[model samples]
Target: MDDLFAPATGAWQRVSPRLATVRRIVIAAIAAPVVIAGIVLAVLLPDQRWIGAAVTVATLPLAAWGGVWAGHNQRTWGYVENADDLLVTRGVMFKRLVAIPYGRMQFVDVQAGPLARAFGIATVTLHTASTETAADIPGLPSDEATRLRNRLTELGESRGAGL
Candidate 1:
């Protein structure tokens, strides 16, 4: 199972560590509401206080685990621009490696939501002839995302991808 993608083969470029910060923020945003709801419920319905306490207790640990997972998961993402293709690798237990040949690329997109923009990170999506091959790499710094988009576009054109 682990032999699928040899992670040691290339000089992989890692996304900024701040990617963890952005992901942690998202996790906290989601968890806080649940905890707040639990607190509110406890205050409003004393008879169901156990439910609220359970919710708070469960949510707090899960949120903390998510924050830790975010950092570990962020470290798993890496990409390498090979001579003929761009390779992206991610995941921990169920790992995946996507190799997008320059000639097969139809377009490249860079996106940043409001929170991501504030965190200075973005996601780069690669579109190919087959929708199944489409992949997105997130947590790239804003500038790197732009540079990667431009480089891929240029490479695709030069490789006669006809984009």
Candidate 2:
């Protein structure tokens, strides 16, 4: 019985390796240059050594924050396509697993930001009848997002049509 479900389970386990939000990357990337510049300027200013030291201290926190952001960017919960439902799980601190039944799904949206477009990725936001149970699955290839959106929409409409 367990073997019977292995293939299905394996399919769900296959997730995009790069699922971090481009927003996270962009923020980190931007911070690196700014922090470096600040540190350089601080070192060059002899009279304002105290102010420079303050700026350098502030950079420490930003560096720590960037590290955390990078860690989050690397972690992604992939989409699961079961026979009758779709599931998405993600998050590190506040882990969430959202299951959307075919009949309950109203629409599926594909979202891409400027950075996401550059990275060739998109997020699939699934809307169901319940607001609280909505699912936002990120780090999908744009094509995959579109395919899933279409498939889910078809499933939902077909199921809803019967009712």
Candidate 3:
């Protein structure tokens, strides 16, 4: 059970550690506003102050939980590139491992939202013929994300030529 999500014994590359901070920031950004709104509503409408207080109190735990989960989730993500395919593994409780063959890749996309850009991280999305086969790896440094996208596109084209 303890080793359920452990990395494979190979050259698995971990994403940038700053991703934890990014996650926490995102969670706070979303949760803080809601909590603040609730507090302000309570102050403005004394008749419904209890409801607002309740909402605010309830959200605090959920926000904290979200931050913690994000940190753990970020730590669990990793990828490995082999001669034939790329392997992505993640999840803390329900672990998942996906093997994407280079020959099957159709295209790659690199995206970075404002928060991710601020953190200097990006996500690389891979599109294959089938939507179900698509995979993405997030939290890579900006440069690494671009490099990976280009490399995967090139490999996909070259390997797919023989197919």
Candidate 4:
């Protein structure tokens, strides 16, 4: 388990912890309302108290599990930029590893959503001619994301991989 999807040469570079925080926040933002409404529904409609309790019961544990899963999932994400390719590895139960050659890179993009921007984190995506090779590394500090995009772009250009 410790070496699942481990890089071949160097150690994997992990994404920021803020990625987990942002995911947890999003989960809470979505789940909190459901929980609150469940309680409110229970209070307002005593005759349907079971329905409200069911909603709360069903959502609370799932949301809690999502929060924990977010943390663990974030920890699982990692990437490494090798001499000729970039490798990304993620997932827990069902793991994935992606390797994209610099010569095959079409472009690199950096994106940040409202919450990610607030946390100064961004996602770096690599586009290739092959749809199967497209990949994204999320929860990188904004600066790092920018740097990675730029570096990948430069590498792609040098390798004549630019589209």
Question: lDDT of each prediction vs. the true structure?
Answer: 0.90, 0.70, 0.85, 0.93
TM-score of 2: 0.73
Root-mean-square deviation of each candidate, in angstroms? Answer: 1.7, 4.7, 2.4, 1.3
Q: Is candidate 1 or candidate 4 better by TM-score?
A: 4
Residue 22 local lDDT, model 2: 59
Ranking by TM-score: 4, 1, 3, 2
- lDDT of each residue in 63-93, candidate 3, tens digit only: 9998889889988888988888888887878
On TM-score, the leading prediction is 4
lDDT of 2: 0.70
* Candidate 4: segments with Cα more than 4 A from true spot: 1-4
- What is candidate 2's lDDT per residue for 1-163, written digit by digit as tens? 3232233453554335455445556666876776777777777887776675677678768767866665564564656787788877665566566777788887788888887878887888888777977888777888888888888888988888222
Which one wins by lDDT: 3 or 4? 4
TM-score of each candidate structure, all chains considered together: 0.93, 0.73, 0.89, 0.95
Stretches of candidate 2 off by over 4 Å are: 1-15, 21-24, 33-37, 40-48, 161-163
The number of clashing residue pairs in model 4 is 0
Off by over 4 Å in 3: 1-9, 161-163
